[model samples]
Target: MLAVGAAALVLPLAAGAAPTAFAAPVSAPVLRAPAGGYEELMVPSKMGPVKVQVQWARHGGTAALYLLDGLRARDDRNAWSFETNALEQFANDNVTLVMPVGGQSSWYADWTSASNTNGQKTTYKWETFLTEELPAFLEGYGVSRTNNAALGLSMSGPAALRLAALHRDQFKHASSLSGPLNWNAPGMREAIRVMMLDAGRFNVDSMAAPWSPAWLRMDPMVFAPELRGLPMYISAASGLPGQHDRPAGLGGAYNTANAMGIEVISMVSTRAFQSRLNTLGINAVYDFPSNGTHSWKYWEDQLWKARPHILNALGA
Candidate 1:
């Protein structure tokens, strides 16, 4: 077993530099058990060394599925492992599960400028890290370089779509569950600013300068044409409390209300993207449930529903 309390080392690189090959693991990764089997890897990046949790396929296939986290991603573990049964659900599948830890409010994008907070200067180069660095590192461990799919929820929904659209050669399929697809849609820019603040006290201006072209480039709705031929899945809820919601008493009521609002925003934005795809004559699998909220239960169900499609795209 690897030692607990492993020290993290930061090796910063020049801004906007290409991803360098990762050196040998700074320390051996801590391995977990079967149902949630995963290896915690500290991957070197342009920003800093980021933690990536990976669950190898039980069937030992080379195909990979990169699962991105939401705005409130924890530094310690991917919420998919902590909050859902994704590891067990994909245990027998012939695809590696890649989950990068931490990103709270980063939006998984390469920011225009760095932000200084609490005496630390941080630059979010997530797009480069995920697409170039992480995959290069994973190649040594038997994960495929080209046969991959990307999935994300909430904040990462658009990120996943944008990555697939921008790097069509790297990803074969993409799925967004309860993600805000249209970033520049009316009222969405402000909503994103507020959500980023609530998630990590992050400044939206720092992430993308006022009216930066990055916003237009990152908006999946704007780049839907780029995703025309790729297999894709998009899902969202109606924001209504449904069978999956089990709010307990007053706190539960508040949680339900919050989920309702977020899911409603997701529904509206996702529908707009869907409309754009239709206008482009691009076919994509879509799941718009009538009675649900923005919560993990629905995301988990969407993952299961989209799995076959993902695997099919991967030719697994």
Candidate 2:
């Protein structure tokens, strides 16, 4: 009788908490069509309010695609919008484009702790934000919480695969463009530390202790088996310069060289990830272009190529 009365008393209090918990989201701006353009949103998160750019489906479709940015993501706009013609290319697609801005050096992962460096004011809870907070709010906009896709380039490439693997119920299609897929590889931790430091002086230790279970949890290769039967598009380019690399001066030459080296690493890592998937009997589309570099041009091309597959997977 005591247990029964306790349950009955808790029901009303629990019901009361629901409105309080969802009060902020209830007050959030609604998704309104802007006459065939992008609509900006401020999604509430534990880290803070995050700015997200959205392009509603041209034909009023509900399927959404999340495009994650690189390590040096900017606060003003997502690279997919400014660096590439992704917005224009997908303007008429029957899928919503969700691009989150401002996550410099954050590999779209939940960090262990908040860093006080590089103007980081809150703990990076990106995984939680994407999977939990953002999805719940998007449901209000007629988007299916489960029927969505995720794609990323460079640093966020592995993150897209990892998110899809771990949260299979949320993401139906996943793609990686020029992403370093192997996180536990030798020297990766140190390399990531240097890169993160250079990007925004972020401390890699805050992401996860080197090689710890937390860090390993973010590796796409470590969770390759979980991606079995999921639609995946993996692409990488050779370090050689392609039509996109036009060296103009010393600065252009240096940039091209840097892109070449980065592309080489990405190609090797993507190949290893493919091999791991093969061992697991997982099938995925792989694009190993003959000659290219780790630049927006190559990534832009990959995005175009992956669109049909992504649409097919989402039934959009």
TM-score of each: 0.87, 0.89
Off by over 4 Å in 1: 1-37, 116-120
Candidate 1 least-lDDT 10 residues: 1-10
lDDT of 2 at 218: 88
> lDDT (CA) for every model shown?
0.77, 0.81
Residue range 34-138, candidate 2, lDDT tens digits: 335567778899988888878888887888999998877876667787678888888888889989877877899999987656767799999999999988877
Query: Clashes in model 2: which pairs?
Result: none
Look at candidate 1 and give me any clashing residue pairs: none
In order, what is each prediction's RMSD in angstroms? 9.3, 13.3
